[model samples]
Target: MAEPRNCSECNDSLYGQQFILKEELPHCIKCYETLYCDNCIACKQLIGCASKDVLFKNQHWHGKCFLCTRCNQSLVDQPFATRDDLLLCSACYCDEFSAKCHACLRVITPGSKKMEHKGFSWHENCFTCKLCQETIGTRSFVQKEANNYCLICYEKTFALQCFHCMKPIISGGVNYRDQPWHKECFVCSKCKQQLAGRRFTSRDDLAYCFDCFCNLFSKKCAYCTTPINGLGGSKYISFNEVQWHKECFNCKKCCVSLVGRGFLTCNNDIFCPDCGKGI
Candidate 1:
């Protein structure tokens, strides 16, 4: 029988040595690997059939060696990133590049609910009303004094309904008798003039200016037949619902002013000291 053939590259006997047949020529394991094995990018080792190989982005890696550099998680056959030769799994990739949430101060993970406005961000579950502590989610919100609030809590805390206009007063307003009013809404009910910071009177919750009150509600002077303008709150005398200003009061018979002198009323007329004695 003919002698067993030898490996062409290693010169080892092929019948017992580990080798490969290339072009019907027996090549030893050392030479076969140099020609057939691929270099693994992850571990920087030559990969053969015995090694579980993974191909990605025109590069080869040993399956067990492909892992996220930050998390150290295996990324074999999974979505991953390789930037500047650093491998990263999807989650780690997103954490490395995503924006931080303003509420929690953490990275907003991919595929997670997020809310953003005015270049600020927050996780949906982290966004909440500062007053009620309720989750605001994607619904309407209002920012007040550096705090976030939902519409309901914002209204409940800051909405001031004007008693006159029946509308919400958002800024500076007048408050009297425990009722709130817009600056423009706090006006004289009779003249419709703005009365903010002005002296005014209220009746049945209706506000009026001093002049308007005198014109509409004051009593008439018995002599002048014009409004006394003080109603019942001045130096005056009254008899049978008839009133007179101190200066207007006089003895009807002598025509002498009776402001500080003795006087008497007869029927509907007044008499001074000398005039009364004659009567």
Candidate 2:
């Protein structure tokens, strides 16, 4: 009979019977299955193998040994910072290193915070008084001299007077060029909301900014008094200063104008007595 070979792993001599190294043995080594050694290729120490093939990459770590550099708290499964030799985790990084704007809550990147207040930081343009929430857009605030007011706040607070009406805005206003205006005085060049602080004024007595007063007003409906869009049912006529639908005009004989009456309909006509028979 042939003598048995030694076991490759333990290097122990096998007598008479052949030593069979099981397939599971090599798998166990990769997964830190052996109790003697726990080191891994990534230099991390392992506590135990979660699976047959999965080895704990950090052999030095007993279990989840990640720590934040700033706070030194266990990182667990959270994102760890890998910046510039620092092993900080997310929570510690944000608390200790990241800068945030004091007024707007915007994240201030490194080298971006132009001003610092009580340890909080801000962008270069963020520190102006007009940049505050209520002051932004229509009106602007100046420290010494700067164009920082957003736009809206600048207009509301500073505009001088209405171009068309020449009415001064006392509460708040906009200044177009050297002229000032009330918001209601200037018509929107786009939507026609008075462009109180609009830069450009048009030639027509109906001066409008680029934003307000874009669409021209057409003929107005006599009945509804809204601009006409060509849905012709009743002919509209101008009586006195006001326009009225010819069919809707009332006669004194059919409807009596009564005081404090909500509505009166007669002879297919509606009348308000205070306005009289021609109404």
Please write out the lDDT profile of model 1 over residues 163-194, one tens digit for every residue.
Answer: 87788776678997899989998889899998
Error in Å for residue 214 of model 1: 37
RMSD of 1: 17.0
Task: Write the residue-wise lDDT of candidate 2 on 29-81 in tens digits.
Answer: 33234544454333354445552222223324433444666777765566666
Best by TM-score: 1
- The models' CA-based lDDT, in order, is 0.81, 0.50
The CA root-mean-square deviation of candidate 2, after full C-alpha superposition on the true structure, stands at 14.8
Q: Which regions of candidate 1 fall more than 4 Å away from where they truly are?
A: 1-13, 17-28, 71-73, 77-79, 82-85, 159-166, 169-279
In model 2, which runs have C-alpha deviations exceeding 4 angstroms? 1-8, 11-23, 26-64, 104-132, 135-148, 155-279
